[model samples]
Target chain A: MIPPRFHGVALAAGSAAGAVALAILGLWCAGFAPLAVITTWCAGAFGNGTRIALSLQEAGPLLLTGLATALAFRCGVLNVGGEGQFLAGAALFTAAALVLPVVGFALPLALGLGAAAGAAWAAIAAGLARWRGVPVVLSTILLNIIAVAVLGALVEGPLRDPATTAPQSALVADVFHLPVLVAGTRLHLGIVLAFVLAGVVWLVHERTSLGFEAKVIGLNPAAALRVGMPVAARQMQLLVASGAIAGLAGAAQVAGVTHFLSAATTSYGYAGIVVALLGRLHPVGIAAAALFMGLLDTGGRACEKQLGVPHELGDVVKGVMVLGVLIAAAWAARRSAAAHQGPADG
Target chain B: MAELVSGVAQSALTAAVPLLLAGTGELVAERAGVLNIGLEGLILAGCIGGFAGAVLGGTAGGLWLGVGGAVVAGMLVAGIFAVAVVYARVDQIVAGMAVNLLAFGAAGTIWHALQDAGRDSLPSGAGFDRIALGGPIVFDQYGLGWLALALVAVTGWMLAKTRAGLVLRALGEAPEACAVAGIDVLRWRFAAVLACGALAGLAGAYLSIMRTHSFAPDMSGGLGFLVLALVIFGRWRIGGLVVGCLGFGLIDAVQQQLQGAGAAGAVSYRLFQALPYLAALFALAVFRGRGNGPAQLGRPWPEER
Candidate 1:
């Protein structure tokens, strides 16, 4: 077997090469962007503390979103409705925020209880997948559509700020806002909480029976069933948990960063897919991926504000990197799967 | 009363055109087991390319040029995803989503900065001849509308009555078996996928050149995802694509009709907007049992077993 040191060096070189390739593709045919432009984009993303905090602030919700995606993916459940769940969380949290005078600190309690609310929203779609036997992919996407319309209705009608002439978002009560971690920075306690939860998830997956069952379920549902693991139940729980994490993503974004839910996606849940895949479903890997992507997120905004390179360069990179990484990760996993599985059945 | 029904039918068809083309293409795609989620983005790319082509040429020529542009754009995108997911064996869902993200990101920025700077999507004196068949037989739609209907029939025939169709089914059912049976797995699969991309692109182009007559940022909305859902609901069949589009299109038209039907306030209309997704969910519930899907769907080929 190859030494661990060799594996590290190889992996680093491979990821670097992949990154450079992603940058090139992002600049070239993906759009009519250039290399110096990409350099500027990176600089703007990580240039200073303010920018870095923006990255962190963005990373906070993204981490939760990433965790949700990985959690569902690991359990062999495809929770494509994370986006919808996220919106649901935002709506619920907003409703809580509005009722703060009556609810008091109880609003914060509800805001943090993303798991239950998010689970409920996600369960509706999961029911379609489990009971109805519709593909998770289709049902979740459909759920997203319904969720958007629902959100739009709330934002424009019932939940309208009453302060604005146009479709308006209500300002969240301070009591409902996530406690700040760093003064003068948008960096909220949510980042630390998100990481802690991600850590717990990783431990739960790597060190627990459920994790093994989840992996087995993912590897082969048929085999997993034969092994007496309840595949449907695990998938159901995983999806609900995924929804909760995704809901937390939305809640954190609104409470910590935006201080309100906007009509459009603040891009929390969607960006999580890239982080989850790039991290290869590992907790630490997710943090690193999120930071790297957080830089891109910041940088994309920078390019738009400064170089006039258009924020899309970052988007192109995000897409290429995620898609390319998925391909690479899949290939690597496939190569290792043979060796990894040999001991199991044998 | 009759006019109301006919008018709703016409508007529904208009909305269904792009969905028809994109859904038809997705039908070809998922049959081979690749769930392309980036359709929203792919259609956006087509909208951009199609608009550019239409602007460059005059009338009929520009229209056909737009089709060519869309096909090329489709190929360019479908080619990348196939390489990543098929060759590199990436997670198809995320890979496809990434493509969509990239496509969506670029279209607005590129159109405004690069293309519009050169007057790209702007109408350039040339466009389509609005066909006046002048009767209940076929009065409302332009020639492209008629062509879209023809495409549905043709694609259905190709899927059912052809050697290529058989190979696609065999590959979908069992790629390894198809390979063992001496079918060129990559070639047939790639052909199906690229065709999906091209048709999706054509659908996107149709939005700009035929129906709305211009390119707009992210104009396809979530229709790409809707079409994909319809594909699953339709069981990845060509006939299903047409029927699904009509069904969805009717929902959309009816949602708007709810305005005339005087169905409550703005809030209720928002709920009504959710009709397509809710319809799909209900349809899935009614179907209740899973059909035998493509045997090799979502299992990357030469994949680790």
Candidate 2:
């Protein structure tokens, strides 16, 4: 029998291999040489310090978003509103940055407000689910649309930069920017914070009672309730907390990358779901998945520029990876169940 | 004033075609115990495929060809989803989302390549001509819009009267019982999902060839999700679904008119654009806890060996 420790590694490796194969097949169908595309993707994602930094920079928001998704899923609350929550966070962050005077703690204050905004946004859906009998899944999707429209309205009207005709807010004050972590690279303190936060989340989920209760609620709500667990309240709190993390991701993007609220911001929230699932809903796993996704994003750009492939190839690759993981996990579960049954028959 | 009212009514019906089509399709799938959140992705696949087919078939009969291509493309994407959810028993929601990402990326890549090859423009005569019925504005509508209405009636009747519909709805309510009675639950679900894909594809084709006459990346927007919401708002009944679609469609038409008028000065048109979604959220909230969905909706059925 395979050791339990080795089983996880094997499953991950298998999923990765399957994903690469599927991606290559997709590229080949589009009339590209598989080997050449793979090589180009690799070089573009990690060949130089600048490329690595770019990849890591993209991974930062994904990490937070992934954590948000993971935390919610672990509590059995499918919080698909990460995209909306992220936008809410960025919008509020931008608003805070615009109003708050530049001070030593201005950055933290902006981020805090952004997180609060995200939490509030999530609470709306949670509250709806709790009191109004609306499903979180459906409410979150609708909320995403509303959030996008709100962001567009904000950027075009109230938040419009009068200095420019573009539909975006004014450039954030330089004082609020995330400090560069490395010289001559786009790396910033945000990515570092993302990693640190991932570690903290891991500790919370793995080493705490709250995390345990959340997991129990996820596994079987009826059983959890029978044991007198506060299923509804706990779910609401976890969902709100998830929203805060997604909001932090958005705030980080504003502080570290975009510097202004725009309608065309990267959709880290949607991509975070892929990351969370691929990471097996574990914090550490999510971090790794985020890094991989970041690589795909960076490499896809390189492929687009250097090999004439569309940058959306990265999304395809990520999609294939998640599908592969889901398939593999299911196959493994079936096999294990069969094996368990075999002993009884013997 | 009469002309303006008719115009708005006409526009509302036109806008509701895609929703009605996709929503009806999703309604069937949900009735058969499967929830496909990948409707957006399927619509996207149809968009690109329909555009390409129109461009390839040339002007004379290109629109019809485009519809066919869209159905095929949507089914192909849906087939991938069916295999994962039906055969592999993966989490339907997560799998559906993955399919969305896959379709979006694939469609974008294909679109870019087509543009690079200078085949980006649609044939001038690709869109459907308006059929004038000489009375109300609704009577003078695009062929596809009329067809969408016909489809809704046919679908509603079939669901209420047909044996196949009974089996499909039965599978959703109690798949194990059906299986015990020697029915193939998985096969029915697979077919139901494929049918949903075909209708969604047709809806997408309507967007490109009939409604807009052009394709853009992610053009279906959140219309797909709105369809899902409409199904719920309608209490999973055909009559309710139509009311939900028309209601949302009217809201959209009004928003468009408001935007065109620029009456709400200093308020960005985007706020108007958000009106339908806001209304959908409100509808869902108002109609909450009254979901009449299938008993086994979204639950994976394991085939007993």
Candidate 3:
């Protein structure tokens, strides 16, 4: 008999393989050369230095946002407001850049403010959920709509770039921009920061007592309350922290990739939700998952450029994989539950 | 000014119809303890199906065919969701999110492909013509709008007075007890999801066929979320849901008017556009009463004894 851990791993691997097979079948049915498509996708994602850099660039925000989601999911609070939090973060960052001096430590200060903005945005939902019996899921979804409207209003009004016709904010000073870590590539300090943050999160989840307490709360909140733990407070804390991480992701997008605020940055927040689930709520797992999803983003673009496949197909595959992972995880949980009680006991 | 008020009211009622349909359906599903976040995705799929049906069927049977196709498509997506959440017992929120993403990506790709295939901007079909109303007090609106109101009345009666509704509500409150009473909880939940999907589909069809008269990618534009908010705002009652929908519809109509009048200059039209959502959030915060959801609204049914 397979050991339980190996059984779980095998089921996960199988589901992933199934998702890929289905995606390939879809491509084939669309009258595309599946092998060539796969090759092009791989090349675009990882074949060269430029492609690798692009993949990392895409992964940077995904990593932080995924971390944000995974952290909240670990604490039994599903924060679906990552997009709103990210937007709040970026909007605040832009607002700060508009007002603060652009030199000497201003970037970090503004980024922190952006994180605070995200946290505060998340707190609105958390507070309602705790006090008014409003579901965080519904409130967060509404918050996202409100945040997008607020962001658009700000960009078009107070933060509009007078120099360009496009609806975008004025570019922050060059000094405030994240520095390039690798020459000849777009790889920036944000990617490094992402890796460091993942490591820190891993330590927090695996090595700290707070993590243990969080785990207990997540497993059974009622039991935690009975044991004298502050369940509501812990949920509020996790939700805010999750929003902060997502806010930092927004800051990274501005500092590293876009260098200006625009509506285009909203997709990463939802994509991070997929990434967190795919990573199985583990930090190290999330890093790997983020890179894989980043590869898909890059590869999807390559497919659009080279093979005439719509780039949205990559998003379709990601969505399917989320389902695949959820199914596999549920099946494994059931199997383990059954294994714990032998058939004779029944 | 009187003309403007009448026009705004007219537009608000038109906009409110789809919300009423979708919100009423979702209210039923939520009453049965299934919070379908995939409502947006289902509506999107319905939009595509409805548009294609109208285009293919043309003037003679176009509208009916489109509405039928939309209902089927909505049910199909909801079927998958029901199987995953009810039968497989997956996390409802995650499952809903996956469905939304899937619908978004699929619908957008299909839309782009359709454009590539030279179906770019087919002229709006003969959408529902407005009925004559003698004065401003009368609703000079599409036939679909009246149908939606009739549906709201039916839903209200069914939920408040029917035995089936009581059983469904009981399933939501205590599935174990209902199961002990020999009711198939999962089956009823599955049915609730399908019905919700059908209404969402009709709503989407109304947008494309009777409202916009054209299909656009993500045209639902978070309207599904808005409907979800309306369900909560209305406290899961049809009367409250209609008021919520109309109120939101008024906000949306006025926002459009501001844009059309160019009166929003320097004010940022997005602020007006976002008022309903912001109001919904604010309302959720300040409103203190008996919360509407079932006790076991989002929890998975416990393991079989």
Best by TM-score: 2
lDDT at A27, model 1? 57
Docking class of 3: medium
Candidate 2 local lDDT, B47-130, one digit each (tens): 888888888888887877888899999999989999899989998898999999989988887888889899988888655667
Higher-scoring candidate on lDDT, 2 or 3:
2
Cα lDDT of model 2 by residue, A1-346, tens digit: 7786656556766786777787778779978898888899899999888889999998999999999999999989999999999999999999999989999999999999999989999999999999998889888988988899899989988888999888999999998899987677667899989999999888888899998999999989999999999999999999999999999899989998889999885788999899899888988788888898888888888888887887776677777777888988888888877887886663
lDDT of 3 by residue, B120-184 (tens): 44334355567777766437898778888998898888888998889878877888898898998
Per residue, candidate 3 scores C-alpha lDDT tens digits across A191-225 of: 99989999998898889977877888988898999
Q: Compared with the real two-chain complex, what DockQ does model 1 have?
A: 0.67
lDDT of 1 at A23: 57
List pairs with backbone clashes in candidate 1.
Answer: B59-B127
Classify candidate 1 by CAPRI docking class: medium
How high is the lDDT of residue B292 in model 2? 79
Worst 10 residues of 1 chain A by lDDT: A4-13
TM-score of 3: 0.95
Query: How many Å off is the CA of B95 in candidate 3?
Result: 1.1
Model 3 clashes, total count: 0
The lDDT of each candidate is 0.76, 0.88, 0.83
Off by over 4 Å in 3: A1-3, A6-12, A344-346, B122-125, B128-138, B288-291, B302-305
